[model samples]
Target: MGIRTKLKRNRTQKKGMPPGSLVYIGDEQTEEVTVSAIAFDSHGMEEFEDVSIDKIKTLIDSDQVAWINVNGVHNVQLVDQISKKLGLHPLTTEDILNTDHRPKIDFFEDHLLSIVKMLDLSAESTDLDIEQVSFILMENTVVTFQEKRGDLFDPVRLQLQESKGRIRKSGADFLYYSLLDVIFDQYLIIMDEMDDRIAELEGMIMEDPDNHSLQDINQYKNTILQLKKTVWPVREVVNKLINRKVPYIKEDISFYLQDIHDHIVQANDMVETSRGQLYGLLDVYYSSLSMKMNEIMKVLTIVSTIFIPLTFIAGIYGMNFTNMPELSWDWSYPAVWIVMIIITGLMLVYFKRKNWF
Candidate 1:
């Protein structure tokens, strides 16, 4: 879901449902579920789109590393069918169908099930687009289920197609690491974008702090929080892999998985730093507003002070009193005007020397 879209966990609908119920708990998805498979050995590679279940099974049994990518898991029947065919545990299937699942790793007897959040920053704004993705690691095959079509795995696919990297020569666990490596790299990319945004916000606050800037700062705080929540659990997932908790993940592949852990740690640190900076920005924003108010009040007070004596003089003359001696003199009015001008000039000089305005 994009940041602008309100997130809702639809598990309430499953309140009375059975424990192993196949319910979709995310945004409404109407798109058709599509499957793609990539089978490759060190010698060659083949790609299939809209592949059948039987074809996927064949590739899984072949002497190669098979990657089956299933997009759009909203269809409960289709997901149940695919899970049953692949022999995924019912609990794993339940987690896969629940898009609200946090980033976690579950070890099963035959397969290693991992859930993670895929994050992408929208191009139009700082809003983040997040989706839950699940990966099942088997002996010779790695199956990835996504909430929808499109992913950050294009580069991995390209490398596999061209046989341009060590991925082709590696096992299924290595391929799983390669896919996760893409996600970790994406985390960094999003972090870099956020860093740029923080700098931009700092500049904006310094130059012209306003309500909109405050709003943006608050929005970023929420985004950073979400990022932190997602990245931390992923760190744990990689830590488990590094500790050799999943038997299907080879030892050498575990070494590569350490890189993912390091990346997650770095990303989490960046998130923490950004969060602090945003809070600092909020303080600066309020301070700027206060200073502006002080300046405005200072100007008004000076104007009112300058007019105080003038108003008093006017008020005295405005009184209707024929008994006053100065009212009978011809030059009294001119004399009063001169006296008032002199008083105003003297007051101005005193204020200038005091530097009160």
Candidate 2:
């Protein structure tokens, strides 16, 4: 669905309803909600795929770091049950189901909540894909919810399997930080792709600017706009993670979170730079178009200027006056032809000297 339409629908659904009520506000894609769990420590990791809600609830404990991933939030009952089991506040679950929320960080007594937009490029086309990902970081467990099954978290899972980096030895808050790192990495990926496309567009428009070029410029401009809107809130979320001084997060992870915040700032800078370049592209396209039009108009005006005096000469000879001396002479036709040629040549020379073409 279009962004505006989806937002409008979500707002309409919440009207007159009690605050914190469970209402799925995103596109519903699954026949059944899917839940999965993973528990890991410094030693090893174990995964439970498509596990039942009851099983997932049991997986949350103090022994190891547990990552509970809920793929679909359309099932309100399932989400409510999970929230109740996890001791999450009503507003927390409410935000999880409401996928239209802006990127935000909410800290409660027991858990911290983070909401952010994850971006992806569709493999089939240039279309951009945006998904709302929510995270709840507790003492020994982390709960995540997505609009659908596919996500950018696979790399983190691979790291967990291979025991790469410090992730194998961290707590739930560290795991949360790692996941946010991956999300910001995806933003960089998107930024690189867009930068490449913009460079290609610059070359194309420079070589030949036309309607098609203008349309492509507009398309990239819109994509940059989407990037700007999506990334603006992320700075707030990351800044909160660093400055809010949540008690559960270890101080060591602050450096890591700061790096993520810097990456987010870099991504935002790229977006702003791309936006300015796109605006310059529009100016270039207009200048090229105007140049082409002036060339055409110059040629037409020169042709008309050459024809004016020739037409006047012809008009004088065609008159029916009885005292017309030139019409009776045998050399009149050749003389008139020579005069017209002279006028045409003179005008051509003048146009060339004026550099009208």
Model 2 misplacement above 4 A: 1-3, 122-126, 202-217, 320-335
Alpha-carbon RMSD to native, per candidate: 2.7, 2.5
Tell me the TM-score of model 2.
0.90
| Per-residue C-alpha lDDT of model 2 across residues 1-357, encoded as one tens digit per residue | 565687678779889999897788876465667888889999999998887767766677548889999888888898899988888889999999988788898988888889999899755445788899999998889999988878899999999999998898999888999889988999999888888888888888777788899888888888888888899889988998898776779899899999999999999999998899999989888887888788788878888888889999888887879998887899989999998998898888877898875
Return the lDDT, model 1, position 263. 92
- Total clashing pairs in model 1: 0
Report the lDDT of model 2 for residue 261: 94
Per-residue lDDT of model 1, residues 1-357, tens digit only = 442242244666677887787777777787899999999999998889998878877877888899999999988887888888789877789999988788999887778899999999987777888899899999899999999998999999999988887989999998998999998899999999999989989998888888899889988998999898889888888887788566677777767877888899999999988999999989999998888778789888877887888889888988979888888889989998888899888988988898976
Candidate 1 regions with alpha-carbon error over 4 angstroms: 1-10, 245-247, 323-349
